[model samples]
Target: MNTQHEFKFLQYPRKNFVRNNWSNLNGRWRFLFDDEEVYTHPSQISQWPLEIEVPFAPECPASGIGDTGFHNRCWYQRTFQYSKNSKRVLLHFGAVDYQAKVWLNSHFLGSHEGGHTPFCFDITDILSESGEQILSVCADDDPLDLTKPRGKQDWQKDPHSIWYPRTTGIWQTVWFEEVSEIHIAKIRLAPQLERWEVGCEVFVEGPCFNGLQLKIKLSCEGKVLANDTYEVVHKEVHRRIALSDPGIDDYRNELLWSPEKPTLIQVHLELWKGETLLDSVYSYTALRSVAFSGDRFLLNGRPYYLRMVLDQGYWPETFLTPPNSEALRHDIELVKAAGFNGVRKHQKIEDPDFFYWADHLGLVVWEEMPSAYRFTHDSVERIVKEWAEVIDRDLGHPSIILWVPFNESWGVPDLAEKESHQHCVQALYHLTKTFDPTRPCIGNDGWESTATDLLGIHDYDDQPERLIKKYGSNHNIADILTRYRPGGRVLTVEGYPHGGQPIMITEFGGIAFVDRKGSDTWGYSAVQSSRELRNKYEKLMEAIHRIEIFCGFCYTQFTDTFQEANGLFRADRTPKFSLNSMARATRGAGYSRGELTSTPQPPPLPAPDTEI
Candidate 1:
């Protein structure tokens, strides 16, 4: 095996999977890069840095490196020692963007493609006791390649608009474990509200698990609600447990999960042959219902407008990782503070930590499948594998409500073939529904809106009246907007970038002032005064309120990024607007109350990065 890695500190289910002396391998490591070049052995590295963190890439600040140029290849190398009693050593990488090839101690294990999924290797067959083990990886990602599902990743050195710079190499946690032959590899939780049961499939690590015993326990808070024991005798194992009363009603009355409240219950599982326990894992879930009845979304059977923002989960400092859990918590909290019920996690399947926070914070999430740069038949397989991992891993969380597959055909090279593209979306839609029918599946966020469960619109105008002029009436524009079936909910996610409320001003109030004070930029820099900003925002809100035609409306942003200055808060998480006033405005109250006289800001802030 390569070596033993005991990251006990970062272990989840902290009570059971405690890692008391875990070390963070997130610093400098030697590196090299070349897409066409192949160096299977770490000893054969050429023209590269010596080390980088296993999870954070060289470009991100957290990785201890600056920025990697676009359209480049990257390689990383590291060494560690293996200890005794480590019968089976395994290497685990939380996530690696683009493509990666893994090697341990001069032995070739495997390679994985896709930037948003986690992969592992079993090093039991090849380990040297107390000897240095070598690790090598190579990654290739082109942020500008629209053929892939590159969400908002820009190819340029600097980012602008919605597109941000690409993250390469390892941008997640990496470690190793010493596990036994008979252990649980993964747990699949499928909650079926209709059957009042939760279906499960446990994947065992080694071969021949037929004699192994599987134990499961479900609970609310710390109190156990249901328990079951079974035997796994097949390559693929499945189990179902029906609850007497599947809902939780401890004074709270069957805890319902919504943006207003998020409740999660704990679940524990173990594997054993008889008296010997193999592996045990603790997880959590929330009892909730999300469905599409008739033409609207019903959360607990109530109509809800999914007010959401386009959250890419990228940061200027950490690349992908938040500065800390508190940072993650802060983002979700800020979204809620800005009057958004949910976020459309654009083009990235987030880490569990992000999801955990989202669930607890009561913010809804629209999870999307990250796409590759190029499209091939095998792309579907890769998408399926990564997406399956994402779905199963986050299934227990209650905040996720919708799943998006193809985004305006980013990774869909066959988009020219309407029938074929339609098939892809349809296939994914069916797959989504099959997994969790309790939730609605959005086939494509802004593809046609007709093919999906709800209609998503991206329109922009400098004037609110223009929106009414274009989509407000039964004219030619409305004919185009309403091309699809009539039942789907029509929503304007992005439209003409107006200054804010016209007759009044509402919508997103960014930290343009700070950007002007610090960076000088904006989503659209046409205003000249804070009063104009306030007016513009109020006018947009006024327009939204006046029409009442949108399911819900979301302004451009919540905070500042690298260069884009359209945030209500600085990039450092400090509030830009007077917190009290921003909150009051976000509370759905009318801003400006009536016609306001204010000069518009002329030299608008520059657009940061434009991501797809």
Candidate 2:
């Protein structure tokens, strides 16, 4: 990763040009800790401790302060000096787990709330003329609060199964880059290969970019199609241009980006004042699409099954953030070793490096919105605001295919019946689609299914015959599952039943093999031995390993959390189940001598659409 050229990392394959070139701002930074004053304003920040790497969360091993305590909030301070010729200095944060406040050289920049979304601030005016300028940030996260999106975080001080320690502070890269004040802030690029069209919207921030000539181009296989210089006098510009012949079929060798291909097209942007180039920036883009037909999801317009694993994105050594880019690569390698086509990133939006690796490794992501606490008028507003930001900020990535907002109704229980809550969920889904129509949104995962694109639910039983009986002809959801469940679901079934149109176990196979002989864990049930759990799990795996009706299934998880032991890997990134065994069971390569009901059992099956 270090030897890769700078342009190679910052580019995204849009139509002919790349999106904003601000993503590659990564490097070393200073460190400090304060309650409030130090972060609210950089000037009030007093002397502090040593320097640390930016982007790497303090909890991560690569970060200088690894394995730190969370009782107190953390403060990050950094100083940077840029040349006067620099057009603009923008500070970008890939993510912070909770709430964060930013200040530039004593000037208040901005404050944001939300743990898994990215935020940025324009600091062109706050930089010094010649020397170092201090950058301070304060982060506060209370995992036990249950008011925010703290997914599977241990309620206790120490971590255990099913729940990991919260990444309480800055967990992603933080850096600043210089751009023209009125330069391109963000670009939403959509490639329609079927229609030979490329739609784009440019978000502007300054004067020079308002009315200048913005030249756009589309290219592939080292060949350019269209290049036009348009005028944009406002802060935002929307444009859609038709490519001569969407090289989709005409091009000899296609750049169909996938984990295997991972081909990228270079995109260059230039702001020209007549013949003079006012600003020149480099980026890249990929040509891909994700959609859904009936209950089956489609990628590149073709049906694709999601052979995935539950990606909790946690490491005992790093908590939420990986130690470095290499650590990010290591996680991807682990997923590939498991023989999964993708990862269902449960509740957390990981660092950019994680997404980068997913893009390179060709991993599809079921990007779920982090689950939050109970929702009221105020809390719902906060969650919605964060959702919008996350959607917009991450639209450039090709890895994300589905957006899941509500998981088992953790924060919201009665949204399907409430007009306002239902409206919020529907509105966010619509907004997400309007921003990036490339992918289909799951709307909400499990339980309450309303006017959503897909009907997703969870169950624990493995009786495929039972699923065919209940959903096949039944007409109501009331008889399927009970509300008493922590995460409600349809009638329990283990196999991937075919009668249930686009059915997915969604949640099951959490066969934990961890033994906590002397430790107390916060679980609804008492601790069980790894041998006992794995035995039960192998039965479940044997049931679904070859029954290929369901779209896909995500096991309880990839790693152990606080008290939830249904993870393939232990809490410390060590595999509990042999990787070789996992590879065989996951890729439809294993079979058990279980009964395959040729005749119907007394019990029933499941259904989609109406219910039953």
Candidate 3:
């Protein structure tokens, strides 16, 4: 195996399960748009007139075909060389929008739904005798379909208010790998911070055999932490490996993960049949915990205030797909440099590379589901299914602190009056908790929240005085929640009270400053000069810091997306003001000196009733 090639591919694609020998099929591919949906199979298409860059959708400029028109169907074809070997071949797709049907050498491999999750197919038996394989894909994404979780992709011919161009076909990496017949299929790591142990579940796939064993080794830096071996009788094995606990707080703090210090424990796994090593892979995880205690958000068992920015995860060249792996790391770096410890990924389920970078770089993330515009049985089923896949794919990442299933009642529009809509919100919340009981879940984020662990309000008042007057004290907060509506919507539904959940202003401060010329640009408020923008930002931060009710806050945005010029930086990621100035404003007076303390504890509130 080429060590350099392996290193290059392992850095970005699927950090959880990585092997030495694999192939990255991410270059040019034959592409064509089929609006009529006439061709059922790859053989029916006689010609491929367009050449598109893989992983980048056609609506973006990086795809080499920047056509943002309404095309529901598209086709892709490519060829690669592979020889029959003792190892089994697996073809993997990072993601494909809406629906996708794949074919290898004109033979149907499989089909996958949901645009945000990954799927793979075993192609070992379909390899051609000539050592060449032809791969084809058909992606069908209806533009006007309101039942699918479309995120911010606009359905109209032109981009509107908060929505941008539609991302049609493949928008993520496509690769292949070779594995042994009996290899480790999957693994889920659960870190027990209090017990000083890591719980691991390993899934094995292949023909049953005797004398199979699995070995796991964990380390940090150059120091070995734990090494254990388990006998594999069945397919899945679960065990908790204990780590030597340092009795001192300072020593244990060194091992814990936080925004100030990110320590990842490197993981290495080996599968053996008797003395023969069948497979080996490398991964990493961190020990971290996030929860709420008496109206305060706690990180690593201590109260921690979250200064987060809303990240849409979009680019000028690539709509949803990142231009490269380095870009993903760069975005996280920029967020941290601006003095934010976390980010609320707005709608889209971002690429795995983004999550990997955040995990490695010590940035907490709130993973939100893309919203479907309409409410229906099909919409509910689609969102629920896709949300499950999302949770499954991101369960192991320690950086993801919260799961948001619905945002501002996008799908359940009648959440206030209709019993079915109310049930939908409660169902998603409970379902998310069922899937991931470790982290908190927010049912409806912005407003009209029915069942949620956190009460998130969206207020773009624009005036610091008004913000202070509105949320200066607990009395004001109570009035706002009960009587006054923030964005013309009640904070919680009529039947649901506050319930003593920690409150946070999830959306605010969308100050637009048009540094460049663009007629389509808009924001909640406008500033004429950079100085004015900086001053306004400083005042807003000051007011938010003064608020006694908010446990944390997420600023409107991190970077300027298309037609939404409310970001701290321009669309190209150039800062409107100096980094130091922005950082100072973001971290108000005495923030670095640890003047901030936990919010006042409210009376013990009863747990929400399980029955809806």
Residues 481-514 of candidate 3 have per-residue lDDT tens digits of: 8876877898889889888899999999999987
The regions of model 3 sitting more than 4 angstroms off are 1-3, 474-477, 591-612
Measured with C-alpha atoms, the lDDT of residue 191 in candidate 2 is 66
CA lDDT of 216 in candidate 1? Answer: 79
Would you estimate the TM-scores of all the predictions?
0.81, 0.79, 0.96
Ranking by lDDT: 3, 2, 1
RMSD of 2: 9.7
Best by lDDT: 3
**lDDT of each prediction vs. the true structure?**
0.61, 0.62, 0.87
State the lDDT of candidate 1 residue by residue for 384-486, as single tens digits: 6677777765665678887777665556544434465556666787887787666666665553432456555554345767555544544543454445321
